[model samples]
Target: MTQTDWPSKVTARVADALRARRKELGLSAQDVTDACAALGYPIPRTVIANLESGRRASVDVAELLVLAEVLGVPPITMLFPLGTAPTIEVLPGREVSMWDAVAWVTGESREEAMKTPTQTVLNMFREHGILVSVAMLSRELGEEKRREAALARDPEHRAKFLDMVAELDRIHARDIQSLRNWRARMRELEVVPPALPDEFAYLESSETAQ
Candidate 1:
């Protein structure tokens, strides 16, 4: 395909995927039109039919977003059609695996070494969020275990509950330290990390005090 043909090829691929997904969901072209209207985009039934029949050679970005929402699929899925297609012509002459195309489109690198500085920062913040959630869950679990220990009539059961609480405490402390270290790395990158959640507000307060 010529470089100029890539645009039409992409549009045709998306159109075919849209038709397939709509049929799989037992929706007619009119159904899609109504759904788009409900979403405030108001794509006409004739437009949907034209797109599916290849009478239309182009799709607007707004139409693509609305259609994907109406079809209950990610917008990228319509563009890339992974699983159904092994590879996609991401460019005129650059055909790659559907998964690789997806990774490129989403700004995700399969190899950590290939990640850009922005991707690294995004991943660091994502990891930091997970650590925050783990720390919060551990703190809650510890409190629940402590309460169970207090209510236990059997001395052995109470001891076991207390041990679990201790383990949870260790987990929470480890997560907190990991979060602090992540924030430190963000600072080193000259990027201001997001403020910690209330459950971890003490980490910042203590650091300020020191």
Candidate 2:
């Protein structure tokens, strides 16, 4: 579909991106014209005017990258977004969607998957905020001894660790309807909020040094 056929946000996002690029690069609209020429795209001032005013929308990824390179920014920042983009921080590794969390855990042995302290940290960030403290996780974990076997390192213990991890992996993998079911069940049972798992908490001082 043409720019004229795209979503309104696409047009607004495009305009905001280009306007920001121009400001950051210290470029006039004419400078974009020169850079576009060097890249063989050659967007004219009037074309830019239309784009910035939302009369047309959408630019190709490669074209966006070429403009970003000429304008001196990352390609994503040119059209999608950067660190502050809407869906970035809530998604692990700054992905575009929540499903990325599932993909990361798929088919992995429970032991390896639980070891992703990063994913757990990201969950905390999503539920709370990026700055959620380790102390919060620590307190919750300390209260759930049965759910969280000791953090051990014997090779034999690793198997047990993985078994515990499998249960957790299942919980986090719940789809929206499953989560809704769980919430309803909890309400019916009048259960308190469950504790966060251990091993999901911060590294011990020893773990941190590594």
Candidate 3:
């Protein structure tokens, strides 16, 4: 097909996926319309019907977002339908795997050449946030173990609980070190990392003391 025809083909693909998903969920056109209304964006039943039947030539961005929410699928899943369609013409005369299409659209493609410095920094911050969560959880777990050890009546049980607490403390310490290292890298990149939570405030204080 010519480049000019690609837009219509994309609309057709999305239309078919929407029809299949609505049917799979046993929802009628009116049901979708009601859902859109509930979401504060009213899409008429006739509009939904027209889109599904290929009577509508284009899908509005707002309509697509609301419909995807009502259909209980990611917006990208509605457009790509990965499992059902193995590949898509992401561009005119350029067919690629459905997964690649998704990655390109989301700016998360694995190709190094496709990655910009801004994307790299975003990814770094994302990873750092995950490490911070892990460290927070580890610290909380250690606190729980300490409390359990204190409440144990039997000496043997208390000893076992104390051992567990020690292990948890070791884990928390390791996690905290990891967070410190991650923050250091962020600073090296000339990016100011987000402030640590109250529980982790000592990390910053310790650095200041050093």
Candidate 4:
């Protein structure tokens, strides 16, 4: 559909996301207005209020980018949420939702599907023995991708970005190796503690009774 032909739901979702983030950051309408001014965009407080209330149907790319930067989030995050299931056409006659594909990819191991909030939270708790801030990790990765994309757009910065990415990869590899070694060491040490004296005597008494 053309941009003008887009449904109100589309605009509403964007509005909801922006409003939620603003509230989450404890930013008032005036705060957003002042931030926009500092960024040289100079969006009025009334404009921000209109955007959050869905009175503004469309936001220009430049404004959205500046707003996202000021709000400490990637631009697409304010436009569309990552939690929604994406529609993928696998074949001419077949289609699969992104969520279903993620579930299939994850299998029924320590982790499962990460498509829905409930499933993602459950999997995080299961795999990490607690949540372990997986959501924060996802946000960090998202920001990294955003920065990489921004750097890729600049010919002068691409080489430096490549070197930085290479160093990041090396660090990640070392961290992974260290984690594996730690796990191996933990496995080598017996995890089961010695039985208590009372439990041992109980077992002996049960054996004798038998």
lDDT score of residue 89 within candidate 2: 30
State each model's CA lDDT, in order: 0.88, 0.53, 0.87, 0.58
| lDDT comparing candidate 4 with the true structure | 0.58
Estimate TM-scores for all models: 0.72, 0.37, 0.73, 0.40
User: Cα deviation of 109 in candidate 1 (Å)?
Assistant: 3.4
Question: In angstroms, what RMSD does candidate 4 have relative to the true structure?
Answer: 23.6
- Candidates in descending lDDT order: 1, 3, 4, 2
Where does candidate 2 stray beyond 4 Å? Answer: 1-6, 85-210
Q: How well is each residue in 152-208 modelled by candidate 1, as lDDT tens digits?
A: 999999999999999999998887888888877777888887888887788888766
Candidate 3, which ten residues in sequence have the lowest lDDT sum? 201-210
lDDT of 2: 0.53
Query: Which TM-score value belongs to model 3?
Result: 0.73
Name the candidate, 2 or 3, with the larger lDDT value.
3
RMSD to the true structure for each prediction, in A, is 4.1, 17.9, 4.3, 23.6
| Model 2 C-alpha lDDT per residue in residues 5-102, reported as the tens digit of each score | 43555456657888877887788888888888888877777877777777765666666666677777665444445444434332223444323323
lDDT tens per residue, model 4, 93-112: 34456444344434422333
